[model samples]
Target: MTMRSILKSWVERYFSDEEALILLVVLVAGFAAIIWFGRMLAPFFTALVLAFLLQGVVSALTRRRVPHLLAVIMVFLAFVSVLLTLAFILMPLIWNQLVGLVQETPRMFASGQGWLDQLQERFPNIVTPDQMQSWIGVAGREISQLGQRALTLSLTSLGNVMSLIIYLVLVPILVFFMLKDREALVGFTLSLLPQKRTLLTRIWHEMDRQIANYIRGKSIEIVIVGTVAYITFAFFGLPYTALLAVLVGFSVLVPYIGAAVATIPVAAVAGFHFGISEQFVYVLVAYGVLQALDGNVLAPVLFSETNNIHPVSIIVAVLFFGGIWGFWGVFFAIPLATLLKALVYAWPRGLEGRQTSQVPPLKQD
Candidate 1:
């Protein structure tokens, strides 16, 4: 076939299904909205996600014959209780540990410098005094800047207090309303689309089930990993146990990279505190066990068969979306990739075949 004929054939094959075209359009529009209004809509998006996380809880309550509104109210109350407890208790403890870490920076630097000096003595040619000094100078500068930035942020947090208050007030309200009006909201959304939406329904059903499973699984993973990490760190008498635990917990968001990156702080704290002592080794072993169990046991039990995305796709998604939206992007990367994969496979194909089967072929012109 000529280039024109081939192009025509390809288009016919892909574009024969109206459902395919509609789906593509919807995807494009949805992406455009996110790209254009991402920051402005951050709170709404956050609220939506929060509602989704709490939805299972509300559903469970309702399933036990609790009234829907009553269930929603109870779930909302529980959510607020957790939020308030974190803000009042957990956050302050973490903040104090953070402040303590910052205060100990000079000691860490001095300890690091001492190690460098010893290394230089052991390998004079490989570790010149000048080069060691230069590297230490750079590190010291960076650490100083980091400290300054952290201090500045903490000091200026008062200015951002209004924004935080707004988020604290608004997100819960939005979540509450969303939960209470879930069916009505869904119906209104569906009413905007075409009456015939077989493909759309299929995709939505699949996405809903998968996204729900992912959110639930991830939440459980975070809690379990964080709790385990905190217990291990405390058992080892590691400084900043609460703060490090929080980091380790969230680090699971990025899969392989998260676990690897989380090791740095854990190692740094361990090394500075215990050097190469048996306690340090024990700490490392405990952390390793936590990670192993999380990967080998917890993950399998919690997220079995939920994410069908390949490892390569997941990493790429994390990098691509993390670059765009940072932490939240990384957190949602796997689910978004799964959605993309589902879309690609679900996209109607063989349009040309369908048409050929339905209509008589025209004579060659």
Candidate 2:
């Protein structure tokens, strides 16, 4: 067969079914919208995700004989309460620690330079003088600029308050309506599809089930990990407890990469403060134990159904999606990858194959 015939054969195998064609179009359109209008749609998307997560709580409440409207109100109120607490209480705390961290950078750099000098003297070949000078220069420049950047941010923060206010007002309203009218919204969306949507339905159901579990499990994991991290850091008299804990908590989002990346600052803070003492060792050990428990115990317990994607695939998905969408992309990387996984496994080649599988064989005549 010719090259064109081979290409055509591949297309015929993958894209022959009408439902698959429609799904392809939909995926293309959705991706285009995210790339083109993602900023404009961000608030809506944020609210949609918030509503989706809170829907589980609302559902459980309703299942326990709570009225639907009341359940929504209760959950929304709780959500708003948590949001407000984070905005008012946690933000200020993190901001204060952040400023302190930036302000302390120079002192930390000086201490780090001392350590580098010792390391270079101890391991002359491995930690050469040239490398030491280059690293010291880089650290010095960064430390010098850190306070300037923080000051600039403080000066410009007022300009962002209005946009922040708009989001604060808009997101809750959107979340409320999305939760309250979820069924109506879903029905309207479903009405847009063609009558014969067996393939789409199957894919939606599978993704819906998995995504819910993922969101719930991740939320719980973050809370447990962050809380545990904060307590551990506090016990060790570690500075930036809230900031470090928050990082450690959200590190669960990207599997291996997040935890590894977060360790740098944690170790930096511990080492700078404790100066290679037993306290530093303890802090490191505590963090390692926290990570081990989360990986070995908590994650497995929370996410009962495995995503069945490989560790390599998960890391690749984190990089790819994180490059595209930044933080939210990283946050949703697993779900998006799982969606792709679902599409690959659930997609039908052609109606003939689908019918053959679903329909009973005709009686032999």
TM-score of each: 0.91, 0.95
| Model number with the top lDDT | 2
Q: What are the Cα lDDT values of the candidates?
A: 0.88, 0.90
Candidate 2: which pairs clash?
A: none
TM-score of 2: 0.95
Model 1: per-residue lDDT, tens digit, 202-265?
Answer: 8888899888998889998999999989988998889999999999999889988899999988
- The 10 consecutive residues of candidate 2 with the worst lDDT sum are 344-353
* Candidate 2 lDDT, 1-365, residue by residue in tens: 99999999888877877788888988999899988888889999899889999999999999999999999999999999999999899989998998888888778888888998998899898977998899899878876787788899988997999988888999999999999999999999989889888888888888899889998889999999999999999998999999999989999999998899999999999999999999999999999999999999999999888477889888999999899988888888888999999887777533556868988878998
Runs in model 2 lying further than 4 Å from the true structure? 145-147, 349-353, 358-360
Residue 72 in model 2: shift from native, Å?
0.5
The candidate maximizing TM-score is 2
